[model samples]
Target: PQVVSARFECPSCGNIINVSQDDTSFKQPTKCGCGRKGKFRLIEKKLIDAQKLVIEEAHELLEGGAQPKKINVYLHTDLTSPLTEKRTNPGTKVLITGIIKELPIMTRSGSQSVLYDLSIVGNYIEPIEEDFTELSIEPQELKEILDLSKDPKLYEKLQLSIAPSIFGHERVKEALVLQIFGGVRKKRDDGVITRGDIHILLIGDPGSGKSQLIKRMSVVAPKARFVSGKGVTGAGITATVVRDEFTQGWALEAGALVLANRGYCMIDELDKMNKEDRDAMHEGLEQQSISISKANIQATLRCETTVLSAANPKFGRFDPYMPISDQIDLPVSLINRFDLIFAIKDLPDKERDKVMSRFILKLHQNVDSSKEVPIETGLIRKYVAYAKQKCFPVLTDEAISEIQNYYVKMRSTGVEEESKSVPISARQLEGILRLAEASARIRLAKTVTVEDARKAIDLMQYWLSELAMDKETGKIDIDKIASGITTSERQKIVGVREIIIELENKLGKVIPTDDIIKEAETRGISATKVEDSIEKLKRSGDIFEPKPGFISRL
Candidate 1:
């Protein structure tokens, strides 16, 4: 397969013959003109570039009880290098134009058998789907999209169109719409890059339509992949190195994130994922790339993919009074990476429930449901695609001033109160900028205005109020969401630690747990709160149990 050209010289007449091998296998010239049939003297030979690729059916494409099929493809010459090497990597969907050829099978005795294995000799290879810029839009459709962007209520209309069949998640739907348009990615002169994609997490009760919303988003997004957390592995979500039977060596296989590059990936049942598997997403979310080093293969795969994930609370239902970090099983580090988190509770409100019930019943009874959706699904997709491809808005002076004022005001609250809790961080500020840019993109605006900044701030405030507000302080404490500990809980832990130290100093080395709790009570901490804090400190190795009901500082 590698031989490009071969030279042959006849033994009888010294006539030289030059032949080029173009077929799958080596080809010999039919005639030498002198008619010498014996083995000729081999003089010169040249080899060309060649490679093998394996294509397998994606897991999502498989039906129940069905196994994915795999095929081997052979690539030679120009197709082996340059473009195909990047686009036709493992796990990426590709449309290959090739000629199917049969390879003779060999028996155990090394003799050619009657049976043959089929393989494709690829002539051309291209991705199955292109990016949004490559979308084919008619002139009339382009005009309609531009017109839709000009509508006064375009934002509200798009929000209603998202998951129209699902009722009572206007905020979540609005966030999803912003995520589809996204923002403009920027690379500074110093080489720092800021990602434009938004990540959202939905923690809700069962039967709250989280899955349905995710499915709807995948449909609206130009390129998207749906994956379940329980079914995905660290390697499956990131990248892996596996043995390639065709090449008899390790080959790098791209994962879901890489496959969905420059698109969206929806992960459902997020809480069900193992710790190690969830940790694999850390770099992908923050750095927009996945790095793999295993089996002598090391590489970083691009994964500029937006993530929309859904998870159920630890107890199968959300607890409104509890901090969001405490309700979900995900680590604070991973949770904080998401730009927005919404709790879709299934609380009972008679009037709202009545309205939702009527809406669903009317839809089931074949009433006119089209009135609920302002925009059709096809047009919505095209509009979003056009916006993302064409719009790249920059922040205006008014927008910058608005965002800066909000950040400074929020930071001042924590400082003025002398609260150990952080009201906001640079990460949240970046999220605000990204959201403002997305808002401008929705209007097809070249500059993010004060109005866009205000919209972004309103959404951020809504999320913070729902998920990050401290019940005791009545103030936003970002640490409650970024770290698992609230300010009150942290203070209680500090009090318990001090009580333990005081007792140990007064009553020799080991102190009774009951004495520490009794002392903490005098310091205004309840016995139950003292015990809870003591247990946490012990778990974190700040203190250790010498014996039953006895504690000592570590």
Candidate 2:
């Protein structure tokens, strides 16, 4: 046998045993010098072509069924593809090698293996000395097509793509587009754009098309990722630590947010996440980075990705009788992190019912019903393809003033002392502008006009009105969840409070539960009303328990 190389490793007794392989089948020493031995297998080294190396070879060769290992692939060509190169590029091109190493292993068969997925591991380009040559080809025309300012057909396509996929909720669709190409921006004390990432929250009913809108966004955007809240964990959505092979140490692995940097991440079922996990996301949403210190890995990973999330109310639908603060399962802090929050309520009306029925029937029957909607899916793709490559348009001062006036009046009603001081944040300025730009893009226009801003602001106003209201009172009843039903309850709570105060003052001591109920009835309050007030006061900790029957002020 042609002996190649000898290496020693002891499975037991931790001693080295020499092992070698040749052209023929070989056997290992029966025992180790440490008094334990068996046949040891020899490690082999081989070079394979880049394209020929599949995911199976990576798992079998590198991981060896223990853990996945990272291997380098020496690509013969750069992935930049000269056809897609831009003129005003800032030398930000990353050289990516064509390799399929870190893919998910689905199943394996003899001489065949299946991989779930693959990703591009990109970094600053480094020039290799030997066997490396720059290949030149015609610059790609993709950029020219994406420049909507110069391309009319591209804009036409984008309008059609979103026009059909999103039915009846044109307002939500407009907001989504602004989030995409418009890109959110924040100014620091120094007047620099500090927070440039955009985050949108959709709080709506179960069938308000929030899910459908997000699904459509995943397809239209060039670099977009969609994930469900129930499907992701803190470590999975953000980042985690894994074993490192080169230094024989643990390395931090990038999560979905980090991997989707400079892109869009659509998260569904936002309310189902754990409180701790949701809290962990606050920093990423605002600062666009995840700072985690665990297992000696103290690093801040980049998460400058736009987030589009959807959630249902705590009790399945919006309750107009309750505050927006009390209706959602998520915390106010997390909700405030979103630049814009749209409420989608399912209202039953004749026109809506007829349209919904016709739409569903046509969809299930696989028939083309909206032939004259002026836009097609292919056109939408072309429109987005073009819009991404163009410079963003500016919203004129007239548009800004219009939006400011609308925002100021909606929030200045002073419904409650605990309400938000500013109905709309400065961040919304950017949101509105972007939304207008997208609306213009849908029309395949060169500039965002005042009419576009008006439409966007109208939608924003509707959402703001729904979110900021005293459902118990008669102020801003947009969704009709507030009617004569809540006023009676409010009156009862007030009467119950009065009865408790009167009973306590007269008795000059703790009030017995039965006596308190009787006193409340004398004051024209029902037994049920008195009981509810007791429960509410107990919950609020205004009243405490001496026993189950006796109540005293805390």
Candidate 3:
């Protein structure tokens, strides 16, 4: 502690004595040259405010899979004020302007040891606005990034650069590139906030390179934390409330998601997670926040993180007609939180197989050939950081019109109440707008263009065609993917419930299952539909079987 000023009044002779309290121990006026010593009153004392911060090195600065190192920085006076403390939160990147200092370590007897610890006494503190600006870019690198952005084939080059060793996933790669350069976070005048981070899920066959892609992304993205779903508990994914021994109260310990705020968290084998663990992530992915209310502590933590997860379909194979929640062990509620879902199948194609085979063989023959990405890992990270910091794109009138037309067209497909096959929802519209904003950011554009809108629309359409197609009606049914039951199946279930109600009104509490089936069949509903609907009703707790063939409303 550095003392600014101190004053003392002597009781022996009523003389006011002043002394500079610069030492850590309380300094006093030892003598006034009048044979006086000790017992000086500390009437006034002032100390300089100070705070210490631990700063971690950026991931891009490490090479050969090394761990990042951390250093302690000491802030003084105005730097330790409450308003300036926001820039020093757990995951925020900050630049320190200061001088290095060393403190000698004390031994057991309170004697100074030979060893010393280093620290920085900061004169200024500045927070970096971008997500991963800890990887500071040089002037030459900025020039190269600007030139690359101007290239006509920049989009193609960027797509090819993501996971290049994996053959032929141009669409997934393109989406991944946009995910790196995410949309700008916005808050409306009404205090409603919209998240900018993108979350993507990959569901496919076991050997379809899902884990490989996740690992590659983890390597490419700066400050990315990788975790296996089966290995993490619910508290490890979100946060935990535990007793704080020092404070004698409760404290929220942030887990992987909260710790990776404004960064990336790549989860692998998501199907292996427990239901409770998946439930904990739902709020964080959608709302970009995690709330904790336990053990007398209540607070919300910001987790503006982008997530890329990969999971294998159940039974180790991809089935196009099945619902996503049915194919994977994840719940539909959890699956819907992902902005984009891609079902990658491993069907055999002669030419594509031959090329992939050649590519793998050549990689083994010459390891150097595996380095085929257009941009190096460090430069790619810097480029993304630069674009995110400098670019903030707003939707143009033309782009807004394009998005409006697409949303209206998709909404019209599910207009009829009888079908109720909703092709899209408001979530998808918001996702498309975010993707368009990301597309503009990648090119450092100030406004989202019509072409950007079309790119986003095309990607959404691709996802619809792949994962949301209903085999029965041959139309894009979002419910088929969002829920296990299609609209037609739901309608049949409703019809069966109505017939059961009519039978109960006339035939007393116990109605035979066969009588209900016969009534459903008379109304053009199939016997199979009736059976499925009865089982669904029983499972949903609407009706129950009292005996072998008799059903009753609960």
- Among the numbered candidates, top lDDT falls to 1
Candidate 1 residues lying further than 4 Å off, grouped into runs, are: 8-42, 56-63, 78-94, 106-114, 124-128, 367-372
Best by TM-score: 1
lDDT of each: 0.86, 0.61, 0.85
Error at 449, model 3, angstroms: 1.9
Candidate 3 residue pairs in clash (backbone atoms < 3 Å): none
Give the Cα-based TM-score of candidate 1 against the true structure: 0.91
Error of 2 at 429 (Å): 5.5
Q: TM-score of predicted model 2?
A: 0.63
Model 2 residue pairs with clashes: 83-140, 146-386, 154-383, 157-379, 157-380, 158-379, 158-380
> What local lDDT score does residue 536 receive in model 3, on the 0 to 100 scale?
94
True-structure lDDT of candidate 3: 0.85
Candidate 2's displacement at residue 411, Å, is 4.1
lDDT of 1 by residue, 404-455 (tens): 9999999888778745678888999999999999999999999999999998
Model 3: how far residue 44 lies from native, Å: 6.1
Clashing pairs in 1: none
- 396-460: candidate 3 lDDT, tens digit per residue: 99999999999988888887556878889998999999999999998889999999999999999
